[model samples]
Target: MASDAPAGEVSLLDSYSPDRPPVTAMRIDFSKTPLAPHYSPYFAMVIDSLLTPAECAAVIASAGSNWRDLKKGDSWRECEQILSVSPDWAKALSERLAPHLPDEIKVLKKGDVLSEHIAGPSNLRASQGTSKTVWRLRGADERLSFLRYRPGHHFKPHCDALYSPGDKEKSFLTCQIYLSDMPEGQQGGEGSGGETRFWPSRTGMGRQSKKSGGVEEDEQHTENESFLNIEPKIGRALVFQQRMLWHSGQEVKRGEKFTVRLDLMYNHHFEKPSK
Candidate 1:
């Protein structure tokens, strides 16, 4: 996704002091596809009490003067800001989340700087090496983004895009920690509609194509349909993979809603055989 935050090394550690409180978050896995008729394992879960109320406040305050209004047409309309944390801090967070996460996503090391990997060409050259590569969790994205939504703010239905720092390092999962809660029953925009909703995936999970005058034309699918509604709660976090999932942020109604989004970075390397 396109970002508006100023480039270069913008560390959040400069502004916000991170506090280490007792790890209190507990993971609640979704046994089946949300709002779906048939039973199917889902790659998303809610980690309750991931942060304390004070921690959430500290993160929101960390944005300070960095908040950028990223409103564009109907696709995305929300305020966003970014801050990078120290590798130590990121490692600490990874440890806290380790018990709840699957083995495949275990953080093994810090990731490369965005410029060193993302903007550069793929480091993996077929001529140099040829080993089967599998994505192994490295750490979180260096720059963590904070999103704010006031009344009438929202993001349209769209799938989260993968951020490939290098051919060996890419992001496939998203972790969004909620800072403010907009509970249910509050009336304003479609029954207090600041909830994150997920919809059914399209066939092949790809764009549609139609033949026009013997030429095929690509049709971009655009719709805000959803059946599952995840209401915001202070200290709650939503973690999901960026595969065929299509979701949106429903418009905020009466109050303000805030969230901190972090992508899980992974290193693509040849798997080592177990002894």
Candidate 2:
């Protein structure tokens, strides 16, 4: 795949034109069939058939009353309140996922930042590694749980760690696993709207200066950041390095819209292990 395209392409959309054949036609399953290194460091994968219907139901059930707030005109205030149910569900998910989580996994949380409605589980922490945390809800950091949106409830171009305060630098990777499928007939079509976008992180993009240090000042240029949008897939997780990557959720158009989104942080000593 890399050889087919010239080097230094800035955006995925750059390599294709209306007259050219679709890029999907060039795809090769190098992982299953022996081939050269085609996967880019920023590549994302979709484990389409990972979760069963029963598991999906259990996850939705764990959401409780929070699932009721997803709709056309819901305010952020209402959505935030609805998101409060996550820690409770996350606790239940943690307990259920205990046996499957790696022995080194640990769930971490910050008491001051979390809402009173969702204080979260006390004894969870994740192991430090280069790879992103596993999608298993157990042994995951609950304080990092948050509800996201796009126009309608849109989140403009921005990265996750940039908004977080404590240990933000320690968060080497960020993960958002989809809890439900995309709504039908939405703009952008089947996988449009509600897409999670990732843009190449320019050098010195997120660096801060002590001379003029304030959250608002630091965030002044965030809107101009570039990114690539990814459509959500149920049971599939999106993970990537946080340093030079910009990402956000696209707006939803029609039909029901809801997702269970969380962030996974890691320390400097972490390394991703082989699958």
Candidate 3:
């Protein structure tokens, strides 16, 4: 992968566009925790050892093209729509985009329901029971920006804007991959305070809490503890529902924190398509 801004399509729909770089060689090795029943639909899973230290560094260097100021948004307006306008061409284009989507989107069906859940590159039209649901893989911005939190650089608690799928049946997903983490483990890398803190789920009846300075205050944790904080492990990806989860990155205290954030779009499967 060339580091400079992707030489291909780099927009919200880039992954599904013909000009987008081919990601078919990539793999999704999901963690066991993100697939649990309680975590389904709204989850954040991590996969370790996918990239070596050097490869991770190369990707960062390649992002030199249009690295812009990374900021947090409270909401995302409807961005765009993707249809089978060029039926044959779009289908082929969708194939290239599938692999980069979230790995697990457990179909919650009690029995085999023959409905298409275009959420995965595998079993795209399968007849399986509950499966993992991670990335919607609908569409995403191709050009990526790196967020480097230096000492005292921090983002406050907030929910990512829901990308207007132009349809209510669709939602979005977010992926955070660490380019570099502070404290350098062997250097007694206790890990900087750059952990991504996730609040309780807002859908149905999930955990409820407020964020003070981006740090979530969960009733589940003791007064000394705040919300659930996941360390930014190099090569580990943190994937979760973009709108459903209230999350924030903590302030960097000791060293610097670098991360690449990508968004995924797809159908929520609330309804089946009309024949």
Better of 2 and 3 by TM-score: 3
Evaluation by TM-score, superior candidate among 1 and 3:
1
Off by over 4 Å in 1: 1-39, 80-89, 104-131, 183-191, 203-226, 272-275
Candidate 3 lDDT by residue in tens digits, 58-164: 55654553433433233111111111112222232234334544444433221222112222233233332444322234544443435676766666555555444
In candidate 2, stretches whose alpha carbon ends up further than 4 angstroms from where it belongs are 1-45, 66-139, 144-151, 162-170, 186-192, 202-227, 265-275
For the record, the alpha-carbon RMSD of candidate 2 to the native fold, in angstroms, is 16.3
- To one decimal, what is the Cα RMSD in angstroms of model 1 from the true structure? 8.5
- In order, candidate lDDTs are 0.58, 0.39, 0.46
Instruction: Name the top lDDT candidate.
Output: 1
Best by TM-score: 1
Model 3 stretches astray by more than 4 angstroms: 1-41, 65-140, 165-171, 184-191, 201-225, 267-275
The number of clashing residue pairs in model 3 is 21
Could you estimate the TM-score for every candidate? 0.68, 0.47, 0.53
> Per-residue alpha-carbon lDDT of model 2 for 86-185, expressed as tens digits?
4444444444333432332233233222211111222113455444333222233453243434336554334444223344223333445566676566
